[model samples]
Target chain A: MQFTCAKEDLLTAIGTVNRAASKMQKTILECILFSCGETGITLRATDIALSIKTEMNAQVEQTGDAAIPAKLLYEIIGRFPESDVTFKSVGENSMEISCLNSKVVLQQMDADEFPIFPALEDKEQIKLPQCVLRTMINQTLFAAAVNEDKPILTGLLFDIEPGSLTVVALDGYRMAVRRQAAISDIARKCVIPSRTLREVSRIISDTEENVKISISGNMALFEAGNTEIYTRLLEGEYINYKNLLPADCATSVKVETNMLKDSLERASILAREGNNNVVKFEISEKNLEITSNSEMGNIDEQIPVITEGKDLVIAFNAKYVLDVLKNVEESEVLMQYNTGVSPCVVKQENSDAYEYLILPVQLREE
Target chain B: MQFTCAKEDLLTAIGTVNRAASKMQKTILECILFSCGETGITLRATDIALSIKTEMNAQVEQTGDAAIPAKLLYEIIGRFPESDVTFKSVGENSMEISCLNSKVVLQQMDADEFPIFPALEDKEQIKLPQCVLRTMINQTLFAAAVNEDKPILTGLLFDIEPGSLTVVALDGYRMAVRRQAAISDIARKCVIPSRTLREVSRIISDTEENVKISISGNMALFEAGNTEIYTRLLEGEYINYKNLLPADCATSVKVETNMLKDSLERASILAREGNNNVVKFEISEKNLEITSNSEMGNIDEQIPVITEGKDLVIAFNAKYVLDVLKNVEESEVLMQYNTGVSPCVVKQENSDAYEYLILPVQLREE
Candidate 1:
């Protein structure tokens, strides 16, 4: 294979695909497959479960393929000055890369050893603006279960209807849900591994460009610009999160987002020193009192809020409350509480575009 | 004890003195002594070996002292909004910190338990612009030994004369020397621990204001602005690095510092894959060819240069060469070399303010 391209184009393509390259020891999966054709050069890397492919324009002298170690190639290409870089097959087992005054000959793995990108047939497709998808992922991905004890919980649930899409992620203590208007050809619900969504989020631009998403059987594909990511769906039914959200509450309070977030963050500092990051909130007629205590210290913070119905006291792991508050962009949010031990629901004052449910920790009788 | 100060003032004082707070388990040294006086509040912390003291203005209602955990106080003060924060001792064992509508009661250790700062008597003092001292430290600190096997090498040598000050740091492979002219009452030499220098560097401003440094017996004190740092000197005779630099050379090359640095960095990427990061340089009449090969790959890079005297070939650990290149601020530097196995010297073209000596690796005969 022989080709020449702008250094930036190659570097971007390499960076995008290299995220999926396997880091396991002694495996050909550590290589990125470089395929050159008459039109462009395509770079692909995979770790069996997740695969990424990207294409960039290059002047082709001959069409060929080479599988090169992803990290080595990235380091070398990243250091080259702004210039055109050329790659040519030196032999069956090696490739020569030259840019300006620098030249490198790197050994290549057999291209046939690379795992082929899985094919998805008769897939249902949906389209959404990239920025909308980016926001939805950011708001929910943090709530996903980080441990693999239950594999399905480690994936985000993507529920699509004809005219809207809702993404949900939950650990045992809290659930995050985000909804946006998106058109879909067919209704589908799939649990995509959170790792894949994270990679997709990093690759996609936060612009108004549309990202094409397709799902079939046990596979999902995300295509943005010149890059495509393929990931295997977690093969298990997601929890019935819709039924878990509390529909009614005994009390409700409206508070400014930033004020509440700041108070909770300060209270969290001392709470974190305890075994459980527990912070208590006392809701009353004109203010919300947040308090937390550890072996070393205790904190008390008060922020103005408008409350309706009966006053109540509740406690929760400060991290869960802080996470939801950080993602809420609205000026104020309405928090509905049922009791001290039941889950509390937080929503935007004007719209239901985003919702968060957090289970309160049982406060020790005091 | 009671005092009120701007949150920023207290936070800055805590950050400056907290660097000396000990991190060892179950120790009172982890606390910073907060001494309130009629005029201001003085914060001091010590780990027996190094101590730091800083003072900030505050309104003192009553004069007393409290020893609070450095990290906890920092976190609390940093999170407070821009307002006056008040600290009042709640009892003999705790203090109440309040700002705006928030209040925290933090447990405190007895102020008497904190280590006292060491006293230095009959000290010789010298003063230099903070920016000059900052630059000199930056240029030579990287060459200091990180291991404690030779404790003196882990410290930087400060050699002072009536009108000149030279700082030297070496870890056997390379030595960095920086010299500047200043007026001093007494000529003295001392080895200040690198850790102390690093903290001093961080706390001092990069401005034209003077920094007063005093040395006596085995103690050195650095006073910059409102902060004062005291450190015990590393006890041992420093190696005579003056004899290590070659007096004359058989060849000399003048090259652009940035160009050489970039080429070396790129070549080092491949060279690093080998055991020793070995890169060979073949200097001819017009160009310098750098080459390195590992089990996985090989790279060859060439850059133009003006060579004087005999043409030569040499090999070195790329890291040492890169370190010197990264520190030199000159547009062009002259590299003086003897035989391939001898030490090479790099210096600014116009002055002897900075000097770097790097020993070349013995290349195996091919």
Candidate 2:
């Protein structure tokens, strides 16, 4: 499209939609369409599953459109001198980008060849504060299954009710949940891929503005400030994680989060050398003992804590315990579990806003 | 080793010898030997061809020694709590590292199994400022061939005369040399692998002290501050690079180093898309036109300059020009060439400290 914009403006616009650009080889679909008109310049990219559209104000001399290779244009523009950059539609399927004393003629695909983006209906739109959404995504996305063997496990379930919202993600080994108050009157639930939520969190870092959420059919849309991201919602029922959490425990201990995390991390040094990577936790009055043994070495460390009920000992994958402890913001975390066989419950002290469940690893009999 | 030292002190010593630790699997040689005496604690690691030894002050509880996995010990020391860290020779093939409330039992190999580093003779030694040696290494190392097809091409030749020292590296395509006046009486020459020089530069950053150089047989030692690096000299004589450089050229032009570099980098964007990555330069009067054409696109950009002799057009790999220009510290660079087929010479104004020779690519007959 024929448009003149500041080097920084176009660069920012390109970055906003760059994540959705498909990296698939040998297809025109791996391009970002630039549409310039009275509404400035609109940039759109889609990889079928994920799509993003962003707009920037530009001085449009002629109304036109051009589909340019996303990554190539980004690198070219990143190296161009800062000032007013001019983009002009030139000889068939080519565009000229001129800035300062340099001009780049980039080969482009036909704009008409770009696939049409879906227009989601705004039936029941929900708005959430960017900071809250950002925190929830970061806190829960890590627990999602990285492998696509179970598609539902790769997504975070967003359960929104009249006055509350709970975000949950679970792999077979562990689960992470974050709860926050909601202002929306409507009740709806959606399973959004963790990848989509990750992209949302990154965009949230750009601004503090609230994100407007809307959905139509099986697609979910998130509009954060000037950028909008669309992701296909996962079908099928998500696993019922609430029922999986242990409701009763024979023992519970309040330990400093940082201290516990450090002990686990140290134990991991030896545990990681072994495939099992299991760290044993033995609790008594006023202290918790963390230990690990592997071919490389063994670790035995004690951390001060306040224990309630009967003392107990448990063992778990060092990585699983470290993950939850590292995420806990408070100084103390309440760990609850029933004997060594039950899953352990880890939560911030005096607050139910966040919870992490880690299954205990069976310690080999000596 | 039975010694107690601050966490940071032991950490820094480990870092100094880290590069020499062998990465090959299933070898007890992939460890660092900790030798303690009335003097201090010395840590040493050798990968057969390269070795580093560093000493740090510590409280010698008892004079003893142990060999621990280099990387694992470094990580353990890095994560240890801040305080005096104690190391003790414990059970057979194991050591206990304790600090604050934590203790690590690391499996170790016998210190006797670690190879003894060579004690270089003091015959005809040379000393140069660390900054000077660092600069010389960085300026010429990039021209060395990465592949060992012709092992000699991967080493930098260090030639020393009465008061002059020259460092040169060539990989057939290009050559880089740095010549400086010597501060020592001894005159000797050696060919050092680029990998060794790179490690020496890294250690130089840790201290501004001058480096003492000593060579014995096939081994060269570089002692900077408390750290010493020993490298096996590349055997079988280095090439005579002085005779390869042309003494005279038909044309020489003065151009701003930054201006020429920027032009080359931009042209590289398109040139890199082609098989040859060649950028053509046409110089006439005070103008230098840089152009490149590839399957993806083409670039035609002009940068102003001061030219002399016949008007000329030459093509060369844009990467080579960019490499030398990026290394040049002066504002202006002298570009000399005899003809389109001859090698081009790039040098800083009024200095023999550095010289770069880049062979031109034969321009494709349009």
Candidate 3:
């Protein structure tokens, strides 16, 4: 095939698809299969688990397919001329790329060597704005289990109802859940690998375009603009996350997000000396005190808060609280605790858009 | 001991000294011992191989010494207020630090457990400008071997002449040598470990002030600013690098540095597909052809050059050429080679400040 395309357009499309290319010992999977036809040139890469296919329009003359080394081809094309570049198939296993006064002959593999990407059945589909899904994934993905001991907990659980969709992830120690109004007519529940969610978030733009999501029994497909991403569903049962969150909290307090962030970060310096980097929060009528002690020393910070309840002191992993606080987009954050030993719930002061539940560490009695 | 110092100052000092601190299983070496007295506060850390000691002026109330955890103390101090912070030794193994409205008590170890820094004799010493030493180190250190398989190659060879000082480093594969004529003192030659050279470089500032360097037996001491850095020299015979560089070359070429850099970087993307990232250069009357061929593909680039010889071609590792080009401070670079298989010499067009010698890779006869 022969076609001319902008360097930047091809670079961006290849970059997105290259993320799915395997960097392991599998040589065949490391290549990006290129297909050029009258419509455009399509780049496809997969690791047998996740696949990405993106198409960009170009001046086409003939139809052909060539599989080039994904990383090297991307790097070379990225540094090539700023003007349009032409790609023409030379023979059975090679293609010539010319831009400006420079030309490169790239060795290729047969397109048939590329694994076939799974196609999702159109029966189960959901439509949602790109930003909505991106936001939900960001809020909950960090809480997913990194260890594969429990495979299901390594994925983000999606629960879809008639008008609301909730994304939840829990690592047994902590949990994050984000609920938003559904923008699709389909109601379904599925678990997506946290890594897939992260990759999708990186590729999805913040534009107002709606992304179409299709799912089969074991595969999930996300299509937006001229790009389509497919990932295999994690097969297992997710934990009952609702039961992990407290039903009612006895002590509640509201504080400025920035103020709490600064105080907690300072306390973290001392907390990091310990095994779990534990930091204690003591909520009083009008102030919130954060404290951490280690062999190096102890750090104590007092921040003003709006609270009207009995004084309570609780301890938790400082990193967990900081993660939730950094993800919440609000001026003030509300923290609720049932007791010193139970889990604490953190959310935006006046909204239930995103919530984080952290299990407190058992503290030694003074 | 007790004193109050600014958090910013403490953090900067700790960061500088912490570079020499070891994170290995040797716990005593990981601690930075602080001695507070009527004069000032002295912080010291040593890993037996190297030692760094600095004195910071502070408001000392009492005289005492304590060994504090380097990483933990640095982290805590870094996050404290930029304002003056009070540090007072409490009990036997604890210290309290107060800054603004926040206060932390850090557990400390016995100062007696800290090792004593090596002593330097007054007889053996060399005084040189800090800027000159820093420049010479930067130019030659990158060529030093990182692996300890050949301990001698892992150190920079120091050659001292009547009015000139030369530093050379080679990993047997590539070699870099730099010379400066500012020094007029007679000295012997020695080999200093690349790691020690790197640490000394980080601590030394580019100023007009002279730094005292003392080398006696197996240890080298550098006294600059308010800090004194001591490193154990490597004991081994260094290769005579002067014999490796050709005295006169037949074919020579001069090219613009920026243009060469761009061409090399572009060609490197394709060259990296090969085993050694080798690129071939064909030098003609008015043009230089750069090419790389691998199973992935072949790339060809033509750049204009000023040549004074018959047509000649040579192949070299792209990474070695790129490293030398990046480090050399010149607008135009001069390249001299005897033949396609001989060592190539790279330097500034007219200056003798620095020179890079790269061994050519044997190409297959086609």
Interface RMSD of each: 1.1, 1.7, 1.6
Error of 3 at B85 (Å): 1.8
List, residue by residue over B1-366, the lDDT tens digit for candidate 1.
999999988888899999899986347898999999999999999998899999999999999989888888888888898999999999669999999989999999878877767888988999999999999999999999998889899999999988888999999899999999876867888899999999988999989898999998889999999888999999999998788878888988988888889888888888888547899999988888999888788889888889898899999999999999999888889998988989899998768899999989988777
Model 1: pairs clashing at backbone N, Cα or C within 3 Å: none
| Clashing residue pairs for model 2 | none
lDDT tens digits by residue: candidate 1, A267-312? 9999999638899999998899999998888999989999998899
**What DockQ score does model 2 reach against the true complex?**
0.63
The per-model DockQ list reads 0.81, 0.63, 0.58
- Using DockQ as the yardstick, the better of models 1 and 2 is 1
lDDT digits (tens) for residues A176-244 of candidate 2: 989988667879888998878988888775345678778778999998878889999999999887898
Report the candidate with higher lDDT, 1 versus 3: 1
lDDT of 2 by residue, B1-366 (tens): 588899998999999998899987446678988889987999999998999999999998889788889888888788887789988888777898888778889888878888978887765567778888888898899999999899988999988776677999999999998998766676788899898998998888634566877777888998888888999999877888888789987888999998788777878888887547899999887888888877666767778888888889999999999989988788999999889998999987778788899999988789
The lDDT per prediction is: 0.91, 0.85, 0.84
TM match of model 3 to true structure: 0.92
* Fnat: each model in turn: 0.83, 0.53, 0.83
